[model samples]
Target: MSELPHNWVKTPLTNIASVEMGQSPDSRFYNLNGDGLPFFQGKAEFQTVYPEIRKWCSEPTKVVERGDILLSIRAPVGPTNIAPEKSCIGRGLAGIRSETGISQAYLYYFFKNIEPWLSEQGTGSTFAAVSGQFIREINCPVAPTSEQARIVAKLEELLSELDAGVAELKAAQIKLTQYRQSLLKAAVEGSLTADWRTKHKPAETGAQLLERILQERRARWEAKQLAKFADQGKAPPKDWQKKYPEPLEPDTTDLPELPHGWVWASVDQLSESVRNGLSKTPNTDQRGFPIFKINAVRPMIVNFLAIKHIEIDKSEASDCWVEVGDVLATRYNGSVDLLGVFAMVKDVPVRTLYPDKIIRMKPVTGAGLGKWMEVCGNVGLSRKHLVARVKTTAGQTGISGEDLKKTPIPLPSVEEQKYALAILEDRLQSILELELPLEMAFKQSTAQRQNILRAAFSGQLVLQNPDDEPASILLERIRAERAAKLELKKPSSRKAKVSV
Candidate 1:
């Protein structure tokens, strides 16, 4: 509505077009093969040109003819496409018919630029709705007919190239992600860094060290149990203590042959303590204590900005507050792929995770280190074992502490464990450094596409033609035709006053 270029004008969409909102045909009328009329539903891609069509309805209600632009008005908005064939659309869409006043291509590009503004004006609580009146009221920038065609041609030229680059970047990212997983699988299977380990022979073996740690952990647990009994002034349940296995050995049949002297043992045998986070009311205010949840646990680095807020009581403050070297494991998820994904809390300086979704484990014996244990736990050997134990259902998948306690792990000697961890860290850190630039490159490609769109819509992309016919003449013709149609729609004066 404000100032424009030399030949440009501002106008309300209502003056330039007729709007038709789409409605869904009754489900009972839908047929698979009866006189095929293609049905259009709003999707992320261009709606009309796509090869796949899922729904069809015989009883027509909201019809869209060829060349009309169809825009999604609910759920996800702003996806607009020109219809290529006669079709019925669902309640989720709206069709715009240019009243011959504006070029179809010109209106398409105009909507692309102003879609964000239109979305802002949309009113609804759960899902946004853009009514016919809402679309008509939207303001648009106008140019001469010939100038609009020139702009469209220029935009198509640059946008096509940007789209190609984005597709290539996406493919590269997928390959890089696959490579990372392959690298981890190789490391766990004794394929990566095997030559280095073979060159050095330790006098002590991993199996012997694992067995000694299990014994030491059992002794500590027994001592703690005896102390609890004395404090309560009562006798402990001897049968209850005897029923559970104290230092459960790993099932060797589940794994391939390991490097010599590497022993398999259950995860619980080496644990000093296994605990979950505290559940408390969270404060949404940014200034309050920062808390973390299942989503904050990234693959390599912790995403600090993903933190939430939680208000905790002073009495229970000491119980769930996170310290460095605590391992966070997800106990519940819909997919087994995410069931037991673990994140190590290293050098954390904030209060986090006053919730039960994240399970924390600490080593009971001094024989094992946290970093080495984290690497072993995350590698393919442990992850596969954990996933196999998930209880499956219709829509639910879960893993419990008892299931975690039974996970078989290949344990190495303390000295070898330190060396193995160092090697793994060196390789993973190098991969992370390589990954960052690729991620940035992919992001930059998308930003460039948006920039091209911005330039094309702003009249800066193409030259304006002075000799071509102006849009003002076309508008006058469109207006006259519409007035004639409206006159035809008018009832005779004799019948105008009658009520139903």
Candidate 2:
């Protein structure tokens, strides 16, 4: 502890405030129809600075009056907010009220300062929680009444300015996200490479490119069939054509218009093969083969660190192994925001498999096209289509493999894609550079708020006034008043004997 200014004193919380632990009411008495007192269970119901009333209790067990500080004591411990109205608090919360000499606002700020320490002292087997004793035992630096008032006022003024800065930083982050989406939207719409198209016309249109991809696919399939025949020690069958069915072209009547050389194609038409991965649970052994889960599929890049290990047979491993340039997508997630999210695999150090919730797409046109497809998937037009196709059950959402295969993609000439990607990369890089400083500013503002609170409680935020009463004298007066109140509540000895 740092040395305090003259007349300032260190005081335990129990000396200056009353702490009340909450008891939950019976579940049968709970209702959402506003039949009784507003109930708060924990921090899950907390808004920016208040608890949002989601449920009510007909018979409230532990009640807190308006102006009392409500503190969460379970799991995420020590976030403090004021009770706006009289309400019932459940087992996960505690109510605190300041004594006569201490300002309620001053106590709130003091609790805010000690929040981190309170969180550290929390204990539990599954979820950490603080006991009622923890709240009573925490010490605070006390100043004279007049000084505490001045300190709170000054601290609020400083924090309000800091909050404004943080809000602006968050607004910038939203703008950055919007700007990236706009860049991708333009790239897919052919507006980004409008000038480049005039300088270098495509040698072949998208329709012709599709023809070449189909031809390549057929050639590869034929070669595989012949190799299988050789492995079986037999000649190629004469009627093999009757058994093999060619890939089907998707319906294009409802598709949107594209640029002169661009065409609309489904993911199935552009990719060599699109397959979902294994559904088996992974083992805990670190030496097992690494497999990518839904979390590994981030925007534009796969997070290798998020991969889990699995023990698999050699045949299953061979079928699921992912190659560099394979585009992976999340097939299922509880959040709609994560469904249909794409990530491109840039490199694989060893054999890697992906989980059933992740689909791997190997594009015949190479990694460059795969990257372009990933960007297209994130833009508003494609995102709307993908999200519309998603089916939801309970809290989880999923898109079937067939629905994903039918996702519309705007096909640009390979050259134009390369050019547009180059421009988009440069612009996106600049936007990211701007975001770094804003992120840093947010972190710094949080630290500065903590610094302001540190100064306020340490008798340094405002100048000490010698004319004001010292905190020690104020504490003695409060103790004397409390003692007198307790004495008044005691039973009279003469009356008790006569009644018996």
Candidate 3:
């Protein structure tokens, strides 16, 4: 921070700009009809360079002219945007207008360079924010007027190219993601294994497998019921088996016809138990049993590290404990990307309990339906079903447990399920390998962007013009003008008081 070029001087932001902190008006004045001017609040309204207009304010309290630099001063601090037009800013933002000699483009890029610092400066018990005085006191190195223009021009040329490369990398990532989903879609729909089905026949057709699974499911329930009764020293009552509830059948209305030897089965039939996890908020003490946070369940990946330890009764922990081969569906999430997303527990690295935000489906053993069901729920029929069952509460999207249990999944016999899953894993792994370099390139480009900005600000981006006046001289002139203006506004008696 201390190494400055001979002609450059570090000046407080307020000395080179006017920082106007925003004040929100009454809620009654806000409208979605675009009544007066664009109402921008905080991070939500921001895009890469400009902001998206969502709300407008009729009786504007704080306004910023077009092209003013907008800075977020709340919870998520330090993202910057340029005002597209004359706008009303909320309390979450502060608008900055450059001084007469400084370039607005220069100031905008400077803010980008110091975003991490701005975030660190924010302080609050509930939500972090920076005071107007804090922003005013920030020190930045200003270049001479002509040199600033040169630096900005060079930066635009270089960064625009950088942005284009980043865009292509991002597009490749998206296409790869889409391709991977299509492969999974094909796998579950029986198309991926169509060739294998042609060459060989399965020992058990999907219909016969489902029938046998139901019989086994009932027998297991009956045995468990009998054991519980004996443990309580009570004899089994007559017609006890009649009390058992049957799994819901798949509704094939308007559903695509399955390939030969395949049938539709409800998730209810595939799972021995489908239930929500523990609802209690976990403690940070890292004691007792570990429970999963919502992040532990990603699409087909479980990150055991994303868990909290809680002191709960052993029985409660046992009930929510996730086991290997168990399929998990997100019950709800704040992001649309994660809602109704599914993952299977390939391995339980730790004895982890799950939260109410997750739904656990313990796949019926002896059938190789675990991986098949996991792939099924993530795409195809599950997606269509999810659209209808999605509900919003407290700004979160979620699906009900009852609806999840009835989700239809195309069933191939156990052998074919394994066959399809093997092909899927192999193909998905190839896609993942191909995606690795793109991710690394993405990170490298981001670092390169920061590097370019650093070079631009530190008297390295462009050649300095010796004819240009020093930034220090400009600051002095600004100071003198401000002093003269303040003196002019003072009372006549203050002049005599100063002379005395």
Task: Please report the candidate that would top lDDT against the real structure.
Answer: 3
lDDT of 2 at 351: 68
Report clash pairs, candidate 2. none
Question: Which order, best to worst by lDDT?
Answer: 3, 2, 1
* lDDT tens digits by residue: candidate 3, 1-500: 43766788888999999998999989999999989999998889899999999999999999999999999999788999999999999999999999778899999999998887788888899999999999999998899888888989999999999999999998999999999999998988888999999998889999999888888888888898999999999999999999988898778897899999989999888788889988887887898789888888888888899988878888777778888888888898887678777788888788899888899998776325777778888889866787678998777789988889889989888888888888887888999899999989988998999888888889888987788899889888888888898999988883455654
Q: Note the clash tally of each candidate.
A: 3, 0, 0
Worst 10 residues of 1 by lDDT: 43-52
> Lowest-scoring 10 consecutive residues by lDDT in candidate 2?
241-250
Better of 1 and 3 by lDDT: 3
lDDT of each residue in 271-361, candidate 2, tens digit only: 7788899988987567578988678887787887787888878788887888887888899987788889877888887667898889988
Q: Point out the higher-scoring one by TM-score: 1 or 2.
A: 2
lDDT of 1 by residue, 333-412 (tens): 76566667766677665656546766776665532355655666666778877787888566667677877766676766
Q: List where candidate 3 sits over 4 angstroms from the true fold.
A: 484-500
Query: TM-score-based ranking, best first?
Result: 3, 2, 1
Of the two candidates 1 and 3, the one with more favorable TM-score, higher being better, is 3
User: What's the alpha carbon RMSD for model 3?
Assistant: 3.3
- Candidate 2, residue 56: Cα displacement in angstroms equals 4.2
